[model samples]
Target: MGLGKTLQTISLLGYLHEFRGITGPHMVVAPKSTLGNWMKEIRRFCPVLRTVKLLGNQDERKHIREDLLVAGKFDVCVTSFEMAIKEKTALRRFSWRYVIIDEAHRIKNENSLLSKTMRLYHANYRLLITGTPLQMTRLLDILEDYLMFRAYQYCHIDGNTGGEERDAKIEAFNQPGSSKFIFLLSTRVGGLGINLATVDIVILYDSDWNPQVDLQAQHRAHRIGQKKEVQVFCFCTEYPIEEKVIERAYKKLPFDALVIQQGRLAEQKTVNKDVLLQMVRFGAEMVFSSKDNTLTD
Candidate 1:
C-alpha cells in the first residue's frame, strides 16, 4: 500500500501540465479513505497544479458542479468512487485529458456498475493503478470458489477495506471460539498494522516478491501473547518463475539483516533481463520433457 502509486500518479500529471502543455481537467477516482492522501501528495509535490474535490450533500455538490467545476479552472479533480458514480452525468460533460483510477481492480468486471459508468466518460488517456496484479486477483477468485465449496467462514482485506471494517474483521477472527476460520488478505495490505496473536497457523497461499513483506505476514500470526506455537506454511512451485523469485528474496534477506542490525544503507535491488529470462525459461524444459499426467479432476 505504501509503494508510492500516489506520488507516481501525481508526477505524471505534473509532467503533463508542465511539459506537454496538457493542463487538464483530469479526474482521479479513488476510495473515500484515500482522497485526503491524494490531495496531500498533490499539494506537496505539485502546488502549481490546481485541484478540486467533488464531495458533499446534493446542495454542496450542485454548488461545486455549477461553480468551481468549470473546465480550465482546475488541473485535477479528485473524488471518491461514490461521488464519481453520483456525479457521473456532470463529470461526463468534460473532455478529460486523463482519467486515473486508483485500486482499479474494483472495475475488473466489465459488467459491474462502476466499470460501466467509468467507460461512459470520455478521456484521451486512462490509467489504472492497483497493488494486486491481475494474476493475483484471478487467483483470489479461485481461492474464493474453493473456500465457498468447503463452506468455510472467512474474511478478506484488500486496498479497498476501510480502517473500521479492517479492524472489525481482525477482531472477529481473533475472538475466542469464533466461527471465522480463515483470514484471506493480500500481503501488501495484511503486512501493515495488523495483529492476530490468537492465530496459531499461517498459510501463505502466495508470496510477495519482497521477502520482508512475506516475513511481516508470518509475524501476524506469531505475535506476542500467542499461547500455541505458530506454524507458517509457504506455497511455491518447483523451478518456475516463483522459485527464482523466492531465491532472490532469500539472497536479499542477508542484506536486509545488515541494514537492520548495523544501520548500513541497503542498495535497492532490481531484477534485470537475464534474470527475467531465466525465470521465464526455468521450468519450460522440464514441463515439455515430462510425460506424467498431474491433473486429478
Candidate 2:
C-alpha cells in the first residue's frame, strides 16, 4: 500500500531530463481513478518538470493535443485510456520521449482496439503498468502448447483454491530450502498480495495487463525478507500479439549495466493483416465455444 513506485518513476523521468539533458514531452496513461495520483506524484517528486493531465472538453483537450504536445510545453502529460483513444490522432503526431501506462489492461489483448492504437504513438521508451489482472489467455501458440505437455516442470496456482489449500502452497513455497523449480500462477489469484521469499527464481508464465500485479507476483520471492539475490524471468513469444505484449511488459525495465534504456524507442504496431485476421478468428471461436473460456481475445 505504501509502495512508492510513482516516486521511483518520477525520479527516473527527472534523472533523464536533468542529468542526461533529454528534456521530454513524456506521457503517462493511467486509469481514471489513479490519474490524479500520477499528477500528484509529479508535483511531489519532480515539480521542476512541468506536467499536465490531458482532460477537459474536446476543445480544451484538442488545444493541448495540437499545441502543447507538439511544442513540448509540458514535461509530462497524464491521461486515461479513454482520452488516449478518443484523442489518438492528435496524441500520435508527436514523438514522445517516454510513454508510461498505468492499469495497462488495454495492451493485454493485441487485437483490442486500444492496444493497437497505443502502439501507434511513437516514443523513445514505453512503460506499461496495471493494478488488476488483465486478459492472460491470448491466442495460444500450437507449438508452445505442444511443448508444455512434454515439459516436466512447473507449479501453477489455480484460482478457486480455498484459504487452507492456498496457505499450504504458500507454506511449501516459503519452507526452508525447498527444491521446487518453475512456478506458474494466475495473475488474479496469486499475484495480488502474497509473500514467497524462499524461492530464488520466478517466471511469469503469462503477463498480466497491470504492471503492479506482475510486480506483486515477482516480489513473491524477491521481496523483503528474502535471503538470496533473486532472478526474475518473463516470456514473450515471436507472434505479433505475443511480441506486443512482451514489448509493453518489459519496455520500462532498466538494463543490468545501465540504469535506463535510452534511444530508438519505437512504438509497436500490428503485423500483417492476414496474421491478425487468423488470430481474431481463432480467438473468437475459442471464446464462443467454451463456457469457461477465460482467455481474453
Could you tell me every candidate's TM-score relative to the true structure?
A: 0.49, 0.46
Q: Count the backbone clashes (under 3 Å) in each candidate.
A: 0, 2
| C-alpha RMSD values across all candidates | 14.7, 22.3
**For residues 191-266, could you state the per-residue lDDT of candidate 2 as single tens digits?**
6666777777766667765555677777677667888888776665544365556445443332311223223323
Tell me model 1's lDDT, rounded to 2 decimals. Answer: 0.82
- Lowest summed-lDDT stretch of 10 residues in model 2? 253-262
> In TM-score terms, which candidate is top?
1
